[model samples]
Target: MSRDERGRGTLEAHRFYIGGAWVDPIGTERVTVRNPADGSVIGTAAMGNAEDADRAVAAARAAFDGWSRTGVEERLALLRRMRAAFDEAAPAIAAHLVREVGLTTMVAEGQSAMCRSHFDGIFDLLPSYPFSASDGGMVELAKEPVGVVVAITSWNAPVSQMLCKAVPAIAAGCTVVVKPSEQAPLCGMLLAQAMDKAGIPPGVFNLLNGRGGDCGRRLAEHPDVDMVSMTGSVPGGGAMAAAAAPTIKRVHQELGGKSANVILPDADMAEAVRKSVFGCMMNAGQTCAAPTRLIVPEDRFQEIAALAVAAAEALVVGPPDAPGVTYGPLSNQAQFDRVNAMLERAIAEGLPLLTGGPGRPEHLSTGFYARPTVFGPVPVESFLAQEEVFGPVLSIQTYTDEEDAIRIANATPFGLAAYVQSADPAAARRVAGRLRAGYVTINFPPWTAAAPFGGYRRSGNGKQYGVWGFEEFLETKAIVRA
Candidate 1:
């Protein structure tokens, strides 16, 4: 791992990573990567234009000629090397995530662990992944690469989404050109270096750091790009689909969510409240799958509200590097403004703010800090309950019964993830099965990287981080012979 003067490890910043080479964008447009903790300019990244996207697509298309023909064993060995390279670079990347992205040390460390786990999970599944099969006496089925894949990822979970797509894309013998969110492009640069260090062939993996309107749009519409994968908001997915429609490229998307966490009457209210608080507050609630909505039985409203409000109010919000500071600043000023506006609307609508309200913390006024807001006795149909805040704020809605709880949870336009806590395992399982989300957690269970992660409804289509994730980049072709 590389170390700086402070003895903290970090990745060397590259403006762009294209065709296995670290280079600057051909265009003059650029964007600044800022430290959300203080809004300090970390570095200037090359803002890719249409031309850069064309170059990346061309590179991937060229590499597909040989890379896709490799045997499974050879591909597995190459992935193993890439995994080892990633392991050696984990510390640097983790530090960058904390310093640049402004997440708490613990949360940043956890993301790093998840990145490693994703690779391990992919490796474990590689041996068994179906590549070819004989269907009949003269017919064969082959899972072939979908050609040049253009992947766009969000700033909140940059590394996780980037690698989640990259690992599986490479493993499936597909070539990829990634357009990482300009807000968090450094992580992609480091990851590209790791791929290079692992001796992956030139042009198989390429990265362009720029605004979605520039590099991202170009990649989506590029004729050479055979498929497009994106993880962001519904608007982002729609834009990608619109761009790729003319070319008819396969488009896979995983978008925003207002996930629900229901606390059954018989569940442990205190424990459930604690986990819910942290789960929503982690990374300052920037997670797409975070349990943002807390649905509880009306009988336990007072008790649950008391615990949840106290938990939210007591959270330590400050600079990401500050010890004991669990919550960091919002990703950008735009996000800060949106959170502030939402809070204002909530207060104006008579939704009681159980704990926090608006503005930065008392002591530190420079950073973008949102108080750990909690709203109780909120109407399940209110905009605050149905919309995604994407901040440290949590909404608590009381329900009349189990059926009511399910109704409120399923009311949102998104169906990304759901959570349930019940005394009886069978009851929780039943509730879990009933939730329309792509994935649900019971009793605050741990997240597994090996499991499929995605959404249903408007949340998005396609899965990531498992065997299902691997298949997202493959196209099945059947051959028939007389």
Candidate 2:
């Protein structure tokens, strides 16, 4: 169970970055890191405990005062260096993601690239950002760092998630102690190395490696920690918020999503249906903002469903290294089991399966791979459409008109993101505006990092990415000097 082993698994996984140095865990306990593509144990990584969380938080608290007072220019310069470190580590990050999360190298690299793109995007906001403003020339409204931050990121996009929270927190002059998802710890380790290589001030950036029940819980419940920014399941976010509530600290949760994809009557039917399938299936449908629910015009429901089936059938699911794989297996067995369970219930309920169903893709004899499934004639009120299925499962619902389409799209309680497709620009924007999501897409456009990202209602509170993300780590202050 030694985490010190080398080769494919990063050695630092066995250790932690605390107080600006690499340190071993408080105990010999280790967590297994497995290859989802093959269901093989990659190696064991250090399993942290409450003591480790204590040490990491103490370090962050100790460094916060000085780091917070540092000039903005100094922080930006250090981030530039950190961005360079990320550049040097990008390849390793991408390579490890393939084994850690069962993503094809091409897709993993895209995830890895977010390290740079996110940092770059946030950097653009710093120069023009409004940090201080006068309130009617009577008082000065200044923004300052919120204080010690604990970032608990999900495994889906480990490095990117860390960068989105930690980078912005650091930029806002707040010290951080990050606890990456136990499901994917290597990328977080790699990012810690990047931070160290960039010569970040000790304790300004620390990484704790452990399960949510262990060190993760300690970090959330710690009194000195000013805020907890988490991205994961709704339950996980709720736990973190509850833990922090006693201390009355700020909690930002970027939780679950069962986002909708609305294909309007004016849209190209074939193209829209294809994008819906591909979009929902990407990352094995683990994305919190994925459009898992598809609402289409009822008159052409059968036609669109057939096209969706063709698209789903065309997707090749296999090992991450295998050629021509449209996507890989679920990150772990739990996710695979969860996905199949939901699918089986639908089948039992006599739901129509346009393509794929309850099992692994036929070619995927092994591994935690679920077939890329697409279902049609799904009732908008059914669990298949109502619940958040973090798998490559698409549920299609029919809509009678634009109002019905909008109604169906907003039917879900979760409103993290929604997609609208239409040939008419005005029509697309109109629908996009009506959708209750914080982030909406029109016609499968590229995901821009500069835009604000968060959800409305139960999806989660607060925002991330660009200035919105940076602001979460900051507190507003009013100085009277009139």
Candidate 3:
């Protein structure tokens, strides 16, 4: 582990973690890790290539049979040890997130803490999970490990996402090779350290640091890998699907979303609007399931737009390290540019911009900081409402009635999540049922960490979290007596 002597915090992954150890990269080229807050080089990670991917995949495949046959109690014991290591490194993980992705301290900490939840949540479900049952005759059926699994995660939530795929796959007795986003590879490095410290058998868990198109695609396409689970953009997911197609491996994707948050006229406008803005603007609006589209009653559009503006104003957007800075810069230059272009096009299209547009927050002359933007009552067909901006931008749309509200909410091609707010719980729940989303809620109910989290429609296939996620890495087998 290399530290930024400048005190930016710990994380400079110099090599790949394969076969349960840190090994030197095959290529000398490196991806420079930067602090998004001010664009300073934090550290350098050795860039990986197809050779690196082959090595990691081979390692996983070599150990697959033994790991796949390991007793459930044995795997759980090791996972608990790995979880303990994660707890000790939570602060450092949060620190790395702040510098690597510009997530504010609070958000970064929350993201880091989520890694533990994934472990415990899956642990809670694994014991009770039905791996085998009688076939109601002289036969039996069982769920067995699916062999090698490759987990490719995005930069936004690296650690949690990695373990979200790895923990469950391991629990299901599947060996895994994780190719985390090259943009935020430190988390992968950190996880590798934790795995090594926990004494996880070599090759049961492997980490390769590289771009999605390079080593990521190699692992996805490798004939030996039994499945590939990716958390990223629709386009990225598409590419992965295409790559894994010929291999005929299972692909579980938790892709992009332009989630809708519908606010019924009878709901508390101020509080609901406040929650919508906060949810949208969190992590500088980089979340996949963020409620970027707010559907409100047409009659209350103006009133709610003003409320949204007030909420955006209350959100502090500036240097991530500054105290009280709830909002920070975009994760990288590419995302910063994409969000700015989207904002510019929306402005040029003459949309009614309620607040914020096109550039850094006025206070910060440098950094990738963007203004907390909110576009009101935008047309449901507009890209602002239909596309995933993946930044701290909210597009509010007007709904004529409950039917129109559900229609507007389901208008997007993506359906990762949806939100509904109403004075009556029954009404909210009723509206939520009509929405075409994997996850729906009336008011922001307390999150169930173990709840299955995957989407319908283009949001990608398979469920994640708890038993649902654990099963994704398993295949059913039926054994019969003659």
**Candidate 1 lDDT over residue span 1-482, tens digit each:** 25563315433354677888877777777566677877776665667788888888888999998999987888888888988988887777777777777777788788878888778887788888778899668989989988888889988878877888888898888998988887787778878877789988888888887678867888999988899999988988988889899998898999989999999888888888998998998888888998999999898789999999888877899988779988899887788899999999999999988988888878777877888889988887899988889998899998898888889999989999999988899999988999999989898777787679889999989988788988998999988888
Per-model CA lDDT versus the true structure? 0.85, 0.87, 0.87
Expressed as tens digits, the lDDT of each residue in 387-425 for candidate 2 is 998999999999998999999999988989999999999
* TM per prediction: 0.96, 0.96, 0.97
lDDT of 1: 0.85
Q: Which residue pairs collide in model 3, if any?
A: none
Q: Write the per-residue lDDT of candidate 3 for residues 214-324, one digit (tens) a residue.
A: 888898899998999999999999999999999899999999998989999899999899988999898899998898999999998779989999999889998776799
Which segments of model 1 are wrong by more than 4 Å? 1-14, 136-138
Instruction: Kindly provide the TM-score of model 2 when superposed on the true structure, using C-alpha atoms.
Output: 0.96
Off by over 4 Å in 3: 4-11
Using alpha carbons, what is the TM-score of model 1? 0.96
Ranked candidates, highest TM-score first: 3, 2, 1
Model 1, residue 70: C-alpha shift (Å) = 0.8
RMSD of 3: 1.5
